[model samples]
Target: MARRAIDEGYKVRCLVRSSKKAAFLKEWGAELVPGNLRYPDTLAEALVGVTQVIDASTSRPTDSLSIKQVDWDGKVALIQAAKAAGVERFIFFSILDADKYPEVPLMEIKRCTELFLAESGLNYTILRLAGFMQGLIGQYGIPILESQPVWVTGNSSPIAYMDTQDIAKFAIRALSVPETQNQTFPVVGTRAWSAEEIINLCERLSGKDARVTRMPITLLRAVRGLMRFFQWGWNVADRLAFTEVLASGKELNASMDEVYTIFGLDPQQTTTLESYLQEYFSRIMKKLKELDYQKNKNKNKKEKPKKTPFKQSSKANSQ
Candidate 1:
């Protein structure tokens, strides 16, 4: 998002806890503001001259802060701060079907945040995303490439995963589109893909069979129940609650015609799952082959004995 905004001549200011860690953003022509969502006091400085606020922040399951603190309280504080700072455009990224799964901690917080943003009276665009194709790298791509167990729930549902780049396009475009203001849109992919289909695609691309491990949804529920008992495991349990949605057998997808029309995006140009994975595997394989070639070249150079210089030895010189 920062990259796109910078390319479009928008001066992007990113809120970061550590400017040193976010130095790459500076290289991309983005100003790094030292701030954190959890720390609302610092937000005022960050938003001092900011016109648009694109919030894609979310609490991870392994985050030290609780979801309520980061997702709910932090977001509420940011919205209030943005309103106070006279920020013109606010774009928020949310999970698809968040309102329907109030039981899930993250989804509940997202739904609540959506309502809060709507009532905050600030011009906001809420983008509910199905899933990110980037996530598939950790979940499926790496595991398949490494011949590790690719875990999947027995009732894993299909998810329309969009490339983060494509998602960024929609987000940045929303800042200029008047029709997007105060409107909620489902930003999804051209098609939804199931776990089995993804596994097959990975196998086909990588030319390696996956070590598939399918756990029953009932077992997942039981494990989630077990994890809920411990304080440290509460966040993990909350994350596991999402399995219920997959167990429901409802596909996480929506028609993107309206989004494309409004955003001036071409559906034909949208990145498809097949093409995305194909490119990923192709790049990875090319790198691996290059590394292998370099390794072999070095090995041969070391193993091949250096040709002894044709020396004028006493015996040879005599001959």
Candidate 2:
């Protein structure tokens, strides 16, 4: 995002918790400002001299951060600061059906933030995105295939999986486009793929065998009940809720033409889920190989006996 913003000739300042984490961005002509979204006071300096704010911050239920901290209170603080600073535009990246599913914690928090932004008197553009192809491969790929040929989930449902690049491109275009002001964009990919199709595609693209096992709705409901009773990790509960919702055949469909109409680029030009699966798996394999090399190198270092200095050094010095 910072890269695209910089390429678009905007002065980009990133609010990150660790300066070291964002140091590379500084080399790319971005100002890395140390700040924490969970703390409102830390964001004031970052918001200064900034005309526009793009909020992509989200909180996972399992992480140290909570929905209230990052999604609701943090965003509210940022919006308030932006309003005080007279910032003109605030673009928020949110989840689809955020307002519709208040029962889900993350969605409820996101909806609250959206409402807060709307009433903050700042021009806003809310991008509601569905399942992300990159997210699927990065977060769930290994988990799905680890030590198992089959992964169980709710009934097969088609979800609009947008490429991260497409989302970034749309956001970059929306940054300067006046027509996008005060409008909400339902950002999704041109294609919808079911979970079974995704599993098959992953296997085909990576040349690995895997299977999708669908769990009955009753079982899913029982899982949800357990999650509520035990207060399962927020991430787990969130995933269960999403899976249950999708299994009900709730379509996250979006108009592909809308992306072209708004961003002036054909969605067909972007990467497809199949292509992304290939690329993502290839990258993961490369990383694994690198890690294996490093592990061997470290093992050799530890296993190899350290040589004692030759006693001849004293005799040589005397000679």
Candidate 3:
């Protein structure tokens, strides 16, 4: 998104906690602001001379910063600052059906921020995106690539997956289009697929078998409760919570016509889940080939006969 904004001639300013980590964005023509969303005082200077605000921030379930701090309270602070700065538009990348899942902590937090943005009295564009295919490539695709069984807590349900690149394209469109102002758009993929289907597709693409273990939802809930009671690490507990959310069997499918009508995307041009998974598999295969090359190179080096140093015998020395 930052890159797209820069390519389109927008003066990109990134609010980053670590400037060093964002050095690439800086080199790519983005003005980096050393600020933390948890701290509102730092946002004033960041928002200065800012016309549009695009927030792609989300709190991790396992992170030290709770949803209230970063997603809720921090976003509130950012919105207030943007409003104060007289920002023309605020574009927020939010989760799909955030209000529908109150039991899910992160979803509830998103709902709160969505409401706040709607009432902030500033022009805003809320992009309710489904699961990002790019993110799933790491979480799901990597494990499958490693030949590890992916554990699921419920029946293999269909999930709508969108490419982050497509979402960013729509975001860029929102900035220039007047119709997108003060509107909430469901930015989803053109197709939906079940996890089992995704696994199958990947297996076919890579010519490798993928094992998916479907555990009972009840068991997952029990384990999650036990983890909490026994004080397990936040990362583990949070991952379990996320798994439960996925297992809840809530389909994230939405109308693709919305994107077509709003963002002017041709249905044929949109990326499919199968295509993304194929690309991910190709990347993993490339890495595996590199590893195999390195292994072979090392083995050849070790197997090569070592040359012995020339030495003079006692009889030769006497001669």
Candidate lDDT scores, in order, read 0.91, 0.77, 0.82
Please give the lDDT score at residue 43 for candidate 3: 94
Tens-digit per-residue lDDT, 1-319, candidate 1: 9899999999889998888889999999998888888888999988998899999887886678878888999999999999999999899988899989988888888999999999998999999998899999999999999999999987778999999999999999998889998999999998999999999999999999999998898998899899989998887788788888766778999988888999888888889999999999999999999999999999988896555546546558879
Better of 1 and 3 by lDDT: 1
Look at candidate 1 and give me any clashing residue pairs.
none
Clashes of each: 0, 0, 0
* TM-score of every candidate: 0.93, 0.80, 0.88
lDDT string, candidate 3, 262-301, tens digits:
7776778778888888887888799899999999999998
Pairs in steric clash, model 3: none
Instruction: Kindly report which residue stretches of model 2 are placed more than 4 angstroms away from their true locations once superposed.
Output: 143-150, 211-240, 281-319
| Top-scoring candidate (TM-score) | 1
> For model 2, which pairs clash?
none
Candidate number achieving the greatest lDDT relative to the actual structure: 1
Q: In model 1, which regions exceed 4 Å deviation?
A: 305-319
What RMSD, rounded to one decimal, does every model reach?
Answer: 3.2, 7.6, 4.3
